[model samples]
Target: MAKPMRRLMNPALFICDLQEKFRPAIYEYPKVIATTQKMLKACKILNIPVFATTQNKSRLGETCEELGLDSPDGISTKVHADKTAFSMWTPEVRKAFADLPPTTPPTAKRECIIVGIESHICVTQTTLDLLREGHKVYVLADGVSSCNREEVPIALARLRAEGAVVTTSESWMYECMGDAGIQEFKEIAKLVKETKDSTQQSLQTLCKI
Candidate 1:
């Protein structure tokens, strides 16, 4: 008898405007970077596609160097674009999504997980756009922040009400895998273990109301 195939969620990672220029302005910015690092590692292990954007490279510099979006062996991004639009859901990103090979079920929508800056603006708009297009959006509470920390919770609340899942990076990672019997489970579990301390600290700093 043949073994049944494991069911996996079709997911993508969106790193929105975690640029060099915004580092000092955003609240708990370091914590956000830490969480994004964890997710990027998990994505690499799980072979999930990544998409990244810069708010405006000319003025904002580029996505933080530490995330390693540009290195040959680092996070292999499907789309690393620069956009004037506050939302990361620009034409380039949309085209990339359209170009992805059809999902196993053909009709299954992609799940977009977001981690970035200015929670009330770019992140919020991105979530709304993804939701409008029928894709599931998970806005990581511990992976997003604004210059003003107070905007974080309010933005999350609005996104949640608007149909996005406001969750933590760790929670979304496990949920995306959905089954321990899958081949990547052990590696992912190890990643979760390795990131445990940073995850906890991020939650405490970035998730505060």
Candidate 2:
């Protein structure tokens, strides 16, 4: 089982294969993008380090603007790693992890909260690798998707079976926030509201279809 996250300490947000060209190919792409933004907002408020990867930028294109790797919401502390391997543990990704933000102590035990595309492939592979390397891994359900809807749940269950905690974006956000009295609660709450609003809009858009 993945270790319970009690506080927002020594944690990193790892985004994998959230490329642009693949958006249309994935299930619930808009919600995936929105949920990721909410998580990014939480990361910013809590000062969590963010490491993102592009799975072959040339073919897959760059991380979507919604994920904000190119220009984030004042959270300047982001690492954009490029890779070919299905796992984020590849040499290039490792280099990004190696030089974490100065605020994060190198010796502290690291827990990674992950999100991204192709839950059956890249996301699953990366989660498995993180677990093997002794990092507590949590996969955000709403933040990851696949080309096939059926495969998404299967991949999430498989990750959970392999010891990675399967959670939703809101669930993880509040868990990390801990209590409403904490400083970032308002910020996260605001972000949550925005996400809800955005999701509502999306649902309406879908209803028109």
Candidate 3:
């Protein structure tokens, strides 16, 4: 049988609800954070716009603390959309997002690459909504998390069935790069190799009974 393939085009980046009080509980917190930062770095180099959404600021606070978005110039905190719905298209969110002032109207909108926590809830709904709105959505699996492992697989299946492309941070990097022959590729390759080495070490330590 032939496997499925996704061809991503003109994708921006969106990160949702990887909040402060909740991040540590996820199965792959460190990998999610590191991979997200790598994606942000790749986006920056590629000149891609990035947006981040938070669930509730009063309870969760900003996304920077959760994602460790510590840049001297700051993490490019656009208007943080606080939402009650899992979907980010609430009135408040729509208003906050409208602060960006698009150069063109609805049909010309750009695609967004999304990542975040609680895969079965906020991440799932937001992606579904985005897809409905005719935006190409790329879900970064390694850059996303759920409170339980079971939710992750379920969320992935739901999103894939709904037309979202499920991809990892490294695959996203190379996909965005399109070729392994650029100067930036060297840095990304080093990062990927390091990540592989770290996973191997962790697995080896686990096997050393």
In order of appearance, the predictions have TM-scores of 0.96, 0.84, 0.75
Model 1 misplacement above 4 A? 1-8
Worst 10 residues of 1 by lDDT: 1-10
Q: Flag the better candidate by TM-score, 1 or 2.
A: 1
Model 3, range 81-114, lDDT digits (tens) per residue? 6666777667765655556546244446556688
Best by TM-score: 1
| Clash tally, candidates in order | 0, 0, 0
Worst 10 residues of 2 by lDDT: 200-209
Which pairs clash inside model 1?
A: none
- TM-score ranking of the models: 1, 2, 3
Give the candidate order by descending lDDT. 1, 2, 3
lDDT for each of the candidates? 0.90, 0.76, 0.67
Q: Quick one: best lDDT, which candidate?
A: 1
lDDT of 2 at 161: 94
Off by over 4 Å in 2: 1-6, 72-74, 101-108, 199-209
User: Per-residue alpha-carbon lDDT of model 1 for 9-125, expressed as tens digits?
Assistant: 688999999998998899999999999999999999888899999988999898899999969878779999999999999999999988988886899999899999889999999
